[model samples]
Target: MTLFVVSIILSAAMLHAVWNAIVKTAADRTTMLGLVALGHVIPGAAMVVLLPLPAPESMPYVLASTLIHFGYFYMLGRAYAHGDLSVVYPIARGIVPALVALWAMIFAGEVLPLQAWGGIALIALGIQLSSWQALRSGVESGVGRAALGYAVGTGFCISAYSLTDGLGVRLSGNTLSYWAWGAFLHLFVAGFIGLRKRNTLAALRPRTWIIGIGGGLVSMTAYGLVLYAKNFAPLGAVSALRETSVIFAALIGFVFLKEGNWIRRLGAAVLMAGGVALIGTSL
Candidate 1:
């Protein structure tokens, strides 16, 4: 990956972490998620009106991605319900790069070099390490096991959508158009959750509304950047780099939330940075 691509992905990773953190902390996760989806719809609707339609072939991928995101949101909410952000976030994101790489290899016929594979492995390891202690504790309990299951499910959803969007955006011929369409399709997600949570929506505090929608906008930008980067880099490389959101979340927790052991956070961050360096050099 070039410096430019790496920079874009890293920025996306940070923003990705931020939005996930917001969701993790929300009082009403489903309602908050619906608002986030609405956030995407607002901007997406405007852009769809202004931008040309994506290539006809790419519409199928866009539809497929939207369906996958429904599963992603559901699994994410379930995971957070069972485990702490430290535990849930790492496990959920840690598995994506390898899964995406495997899917890309099978479906897209994209085989990465050995060094790049090593980098992805290192990133996966570092992400898991970031939440090792919390994960271990969660595993020893029933709820933790439930969290583990849901988090793993979330990982699958993430990988599926990442590959879907990666291929979709590449074929779309216009990244912005593809992105806008994808965002606009999120209306389904918002509507589904909103209808289910209608009774609760009217009771939500103003703060919750603002934060949820704001996080949605941030999430949109983050994924938009990832889709843009996928156009230039291999899927596995981009996925691994993007999963650095785990590291960013850990750092955010340590610095701002005053959570976790410093030694562990620092160690995980170092490993992630080294992994990034390897991937950057491999290309």
Candidate 2:
């Protein structure tokens, strides 16, 4: 990725981490997830009129992206139900790039240079190191262990959907079309799940809507920027760099929330830096 592209990806990663942290910190996790989905839906739905939709062939990508994204929502909800942002976020975000890289090699016929592959290995190890201390400390106790499992499962969906969406959008010739339509599907799937559980309508706390909307806007901007950039970059490269959000989330927790252990966070920082250096040098 070019510096400009990398910078935009980093900015989007920050926003991505922030919004998820917002959900992870929320009083109503599922509702917060739903609202974020709903928030994106309105904006995306609005874009249909203001911009011209692509040709008929683009619809498959749009539809595929929608279904895959719905899977993302479902997995994310279950993952959030399981644990803390610090514990779950890194695993959920970090693991996908490796998978994306592998998937790209198998299907996309995109081969990584030896050095780049090494860097990716480092990233994989770094992600594990991010949680190394916690895992060793017997950190996952009771619910935390369950959360870890759920979160990892959610990460699988992240990888699968992203891979599918990346291919879909690239084929569609207009990534925004796929993304906007996917937004609608996400909300629809979220709504159905919510209603089935009788947890659909959250009576927003008097002030929560403001925060939810703020988070949603950030979330949307981040996705838009990343998806646009993904169009130019290798899918694996894009996926790997996005995992930098783990470091950002750790910093946000430490600097703002005054939570988490610094030593582990510092280790995460180093791992993230390694991942970036890998991509930076590779590019």
Candidate 3:
């Protein structure tokens, strides 16, 4: 990938980490998630009015992505409830690069080089390293295992939606339009969750609403940048690079959430940085 594309993806990765941190720190994860989805819908509505519709061919992928994202939000909320940001975020995002690669190869017929595969492996390994302590200590317990399960499921959802939107944006002709429609479709997700958590929503303070919706806006921008980059780069490469958010999450967890050992996280960050270098050069 070009430096420009790489930079774009990295910016998105940072933003992604920020939003996930918001959710992880929130008092009510489910309600926060609903507001985040509502965040997408608010701007998406205006964008849909300003931008033209995506191609009909890509609409199916858009719908598929929306469904997958619902599963993603649910799994993410559950994962955070059970584990720390450093641990759950790594497990959730670490697997996406490899899974997206496999999906891209199988469905999109896009084969990556051996070096790229090496980079992906390093990234995945580094992610595990970030949570090595938690995994070792917590895996034997039921809650730990549950967190792991939910995190892995979140990874699957991410991979599914990444590939879907990657291909969808390519076919849409206008990346902004495709993204607007995709974001708009999250209205359903927000509505469903809102209805289920009506009392919670009603009870939330103004500060919580501001934070939740702001997080949603950040999430929307992060994914939009990724979708735009996909039009110019390989899906697997973009996915791998975007997942650098895991490293950012580790730092955020250590510094802000008071989770995990900083020494281990620093080592993991080095490994992930190396992985990014390899992927960037290979592409």
Candidate 4:
């Protein structure tokens, strides 16, 4: 990747970590998630009117991506409910790059070079390392097992949408239009979650709205950048670079969520940075 692309992807990574932290801290994750989806719709509804419709060729990918994202949000909410942010975030985000790379090669015909593969492995290893101490700290087997299962499911959903949007944006001919449409589609996810949490919505306070909506905007911008970068770089490489967000999430968990074992996490961050460097140099 060029410096410009790398910078955009890194910024996206930070924003993504921040939003996940916001969700991780919420008392009612499903309700908070619905509000976040509403945040996307609020802005997206306006943009859809202003922006031109995406190409017909891109609509299928957009619809596919939207459906996958619904599953992503559902699984993510469940994962957070069952595990710590540090543990859940790493496993969920860590596995996506490799999966995206594999799918991109198999389905998208995007072949990565050797160094890029090395970088992906290093980043994946670092991500797993970041969560090692916590996973080994003797949490209950039942909760731990459930969290792992949910986290892995969330990872698969992420990879599904990552590839879907990456190709969708490319086919759309206009990144902004594609992004707006994708955001607008979030209404379906919001409505689904909202119906499930209908009894809880009226009770949500202003603070919850602010956090959820604000985080949603950030989340939208972060993924928007990723979609844009996908237009210029290999999907797998871009996805691997984006996994650096795991480092940010670990720090966020340590500082804000009062999660412990900073030394190991910091070490993991270094490995992630090294992996990023390898990928950047290869580009």
Q: What is the TM-score of each predicted model, taking all chains together?
A: 0.96, 0.88, 0.94, 0.94
C-alpha positional error of residue 37 in candidate 3 after TM-score superposition, expressed in Å: 0.7
- How much lDDT does candidate 4 score? 0.88
Candidate 2 lowest-lDDT run of ten: 134-143
What lDDT does the true structure give each of the candidates? 0.90, 0.73, 0.89, 0.88
- lDDT-best of 1 and 2: 1
Per-residue lDDT of candidate 3, residues 66-100 (tens digit): 88988887898788778765567678888999999
Q: What is the lDDT of candidate 1?
A: 0.90
Off by over 4 Å in 4: 80-84, 138-140, 144-146
What clash count does candidate 4 reach? 0
> What are the RMSDs of all candidates, in order?
1.3, 2.5, 1.7, 1.7
Consecutive 10-residue window with the lowest summed lDDT within model 3: 135-144
| Per-residue lDDT over 1-283 for candidate 2, one digit per residue giving the tens place of the 0 to 100 score | 6889988888998999899789878877766776677677777787765666755676776677677666666666676666655566667776888888888888888787766666666666666666665555446464566777777887887887677766766766676776676665556755764576453355556477677767877888887787787678777888887777777876787788886678877876787777778787786
Pairs in steric clash, model 3:
1-283
lDDT of 4 by residue, 145-261 (tens): 778888999999999999999999999999999999999999998999889898898888888889999999999999889999999999999999899888888888889778868
> How big is the positional error of residue 121 in model 2, measured in Å on the Cα after superposition?
2.6
